[model samples]
Target: MAEREREPAGWQLEQSAPEAYERYLVPPMFAPWAERLIDATDFERDDRVLDVGCGTGIVARRITDRPGGVGTVVGLDINEKMLEVAETAAAKSQLEIEWRRGDVTDLPFSDGAFDVVLCQQALQFVTDPSAAFREMRRVLGPGGRVAASVWRPLEYNSGYVELAEALERHVGDDAETMMRSPFPEWTGEDLGTLVRDAGFSESLRTIEIGSMRYPSVEEFVRREAASSPLSEPLGNIEPDVREALIEEVRNALEDYIDDEGIVFPMESHLLTAQR
Candidate 1:
């Protein structure tokens, strides 16, 4: 039998993961942050919005539900499966959202096409986040807003940090590094730089959202294992190693659990830019 190879290192895995579980998993994990982002935008009823990298239309759906928010909301994503899920969810809510399959860096809209372009938890996956920002700027009308958020270093994100540590302990020394650096590791400064280069003036206050707390370690693990494409790669690991990884992750959570349940801290940067 031919030996299996490790998945290539880059943004491709982030762009496309063939797991329905993972794709649908993000909404619940990020519900708190998602609501905060929507509130930050203070979306108006008539704003013609474009949600870039609009995975499953979390942002898009929210906007559609806004009072007097009957204006158009166009959500674009490269993964059709994600769009499909978003479409179904949107339909259930009796909301109308135009979900299209398209790359973030290569948007299919005309210049000055939208009043606001929003992206949430998606910049990290773009091979060229700077290019994606530029595309976002191009699609926005003058004085429009570009809003985005990205996870900070794995160290600040307990879920990812623990997962990386677990992968290292069980899989190999390279596992932690590979998982930690899954996409481009960005800080607030890095995100600011990318937005500035894309021709958007960064808002002085980098609206920092509070850390997310999961009810319990088991629930946290379940959501992560189900939601992130990270699980897809585990199938490549040896079964023994995979089992060890699960145990290690469980052990790591012991430090964070309390009578109130596991309170893992997840830090991410939310920024608004004026185009």
Candidate 2:
């Protein structure tokens, strides 16, 4: 018997990865965390601010919207597609944000150029986070502050654990690896040490606990895949395999599901310091 071939309707993302990321992931996960990261710093109205790895300009946009507004808000990212989306969004809102495409490890700016450096959920993806931290410190003036956030680990994010295991079982090791890459295995003390080694002073690491909610387990899987590199692979997989993967996650997260949808607690290490 031949298995029928059918594409899951939810798997169809009729937009670019960055666009989907802005539509799906930013609102739920990144935007709220952006607020927390901003709160960790002494962001003044007239201070020059730089948002490292500013995906879709959430943090940059938020800074401009703060009371009395901000001065010279710049958002830097390595992905051109993300920068394009960010530029368009800022222009639409008439925001004077400068979107620059550059690497965090080597910022294309002069020394002591910014007053505050804010990175939200991006330190983990850097190939050399310590170098990136040093660059952040270099761009900050004396008494400037740097605030960044990184997911604690997979163990602390149980929903992702179930999803990663299901991906390995049904998709492949590569898919599982892609899903788990965001959650770094670094402790709070390790984050403090990294920034201190990079010449940051008075480093403070705090564990911020938050929750993410999806309309359902299926939407959770669908949105996560659509917004990330997994979109192509998940969209290309056999429909039955995709179904099994979602089902496994659904069963595993049944306890977390409620009348609204699937809700799970997420944890991250917020590191703040002065340069």
Q: Which candidate is the best by TM-score?
A: 2
Question: How do the predictions measure up, each by TM-score?
Answer: 0.82, 0.96
TM-score of 1: 0.82
Badly placed stretches (over 4 Å) of model 1 are 1-24, 172-178, 181-184, 205-219, 235-243, 259-261
lDDT of 2 by residue, 77-108 (tens): 99999999999989998989999999999999
Per-residue lDDT of model 1, residues 1-275, tens digit only: 11121221212333334343334345445556667677777566677899888887788888788766747999999988888878887898898889999998999999999988889888877789888999999998877887787777776776678877777666666556656763356777887888888888756336354654555554454444444555555536665665566567768777876665556666778888888
- Best model number under lDDT: 2
Give each model's clash number.
1, 0
Name the lDDT value of residue 53 in candidate 1.
81
Q: Model 1 lDDT vs. the true structure?
A: 0.70
Per-residue error at 133 for model 2, in Å?
0.7
